[model samples]
Target chain A: MKLAHIQQILQAEVLTGAGSLDREVGMAFSADLISDILVMCKEHTLLLTGMTHIQIVKTAEICDLAAVVFVRGKRPGPEAIALAAQNDIPLLLSSLTMYESAGLLYCAGLPGISRNPDPCGRAKGERTG
Target chain B: MSEQAKPEQILILEFTLKSLDFMRAGEASSEFKQRLKKLGFKPELVRRAAIAAYEAEMNVIIHARKGVMRFEIAPARLLIVVEDEGPGISDIEQAMQEGFTTASAAIRELGFGAGMGLPNIKRCADAMDIQSIPGQGTRLQIIINNE
Candidate 1:
């Protein structure tokens, strides 16, 4: 899905990368934990996170994420916005909850990245029975 | 013509990390990633190396008093060695376990301290080695093959 489409769907404000709205993103991953993103995120996936720190931008850069949408009405400070602009990472802010944002995107034909929660490949609550 | 085989060339990069320096934490690994890209490693290889290196570097920035990250790049592989002066892990085995973290609530607010750093690094690298003294410090080495 194009980022412009995502912005409109969630009613998010583009903090930066206004020029990048036309870029296409195929997958989306929502997480508040940076480590979860680090360990599980696929390259070029769009990131929907509530954390408004600069590390989110750094994680996106390291993982080559498509863009970051801050859910729950979170707003990153100037420094975070500056770094994202410097790194060419688009930052968006939305009033929707993480669940709502993710649901809207999923319903709009954007698929979420899937991963086994455990590295061992066992389902989180699977029973042998 | 020289009969001896040519010695393999290695590129080296060194970086200093300070604890709680959240603003500049990932700069070193970002540079390493860019360098690898400029040298033309495959994107998958570059991403793996960058993720491993960034996690290692963040470990230092999150827990150490100070540390150094050294990168050794060869045609076949990339080796990253991070040495830090901090409260070293008393149990390497436990520290390597996923979801076992010592990070404080403040660190968690920054979206870290999930105890997945070492395990994630291991997942990204082909080989990993760690040595630490409870009070003295810790040293970590990670190698990601170009293949």
Candidate 2:
């Protein structure tokens, strides 16, 4: 889905990267735990979380995520927004609670990327850098 | 491939840990990951490097008075050296135990005080070595295979 559509559906405020609103997102995940995010998120996925911190932006950068949506009107500090800008990761703030935001995205046909059925399964596509 | 003709390139970054400035903590790791990407490191390796380095960075910020990180890169491996003058860990064994943490409530609220930093480091690095003295300092050497 396009980022602009996501913003409209969730009623989110785009804090940065407004020009990238037409970018497409392939999947979504809702969590504040960095470890789980590291293991589960796919490239270009939308991140929904309640935690507002610089590390969240850093994590998004490392994982190459498309954007972040802050739940429950949580305002990420300036440092977080600055880091997001530097990394070219879009940052959005949503007044909706985490469950409602995630449900909205899910109901809109955005599915979470499931890990391979086998814990040791290898990814079946070209490796990315 | 001509091994003798290729020059080794080393990328180094140094960051100061401001004792209680939680907001600026992950800047170094973010820069480090960017460097790794510019070098064409695989995503899996990049993920491992970022997780290990970020965890170590957080440790220094929450537990140490000051810290420095040095990274060396080659076609075959990535070496990360993290040194800190923080109150050294009293027990490496206990510290390596998953879910063991001395992080404050404030750190926990940031989502990392889960006591999984060291273990996560071990899980990500191909070879890991840590040396610490209770009152002196701590040094960690982590080697990650580029394969």
Task: Tell me the DockQ of each model, to 2 decimals.
Answer: 0.72, 0.41
Identify the leading candidate in terms of TM-score.
Answer: 1
TM (chain A), candidate 2 = 0.87
lDDT of 2 by residue, B72-103 (tens): 76778888888989789899999999778888
Model 2 residue B83 distance off true place after TM-score fit, in angstroms: 1.2
Candidate 2 lDDT score at position A94: 93
Query: Model 1: per-residue lDDT, tens digit, A1-129?
Result: 899999999999999999999999988999999999999999889999989988999999999999999999999999899999998899999999999999888766688787323422235443332
What TM-scores do the predictions have? 0.91, 0.83
Off by over 4 Å in 1: A115-129, B1-7
Q: Kindly give the number of clashing pairs for every candidate.
A: 0, 1
lDDT of 1: 0.91
Q: Which residue pairs does candidate 2 place in steric collision?
A: B64-B86
Give the alpha carbon lDDT tens digit for every residue of B3-97 in model 1.
12235868888888999999889999999998899999999999999999999999999999999898988889899999999999999999999
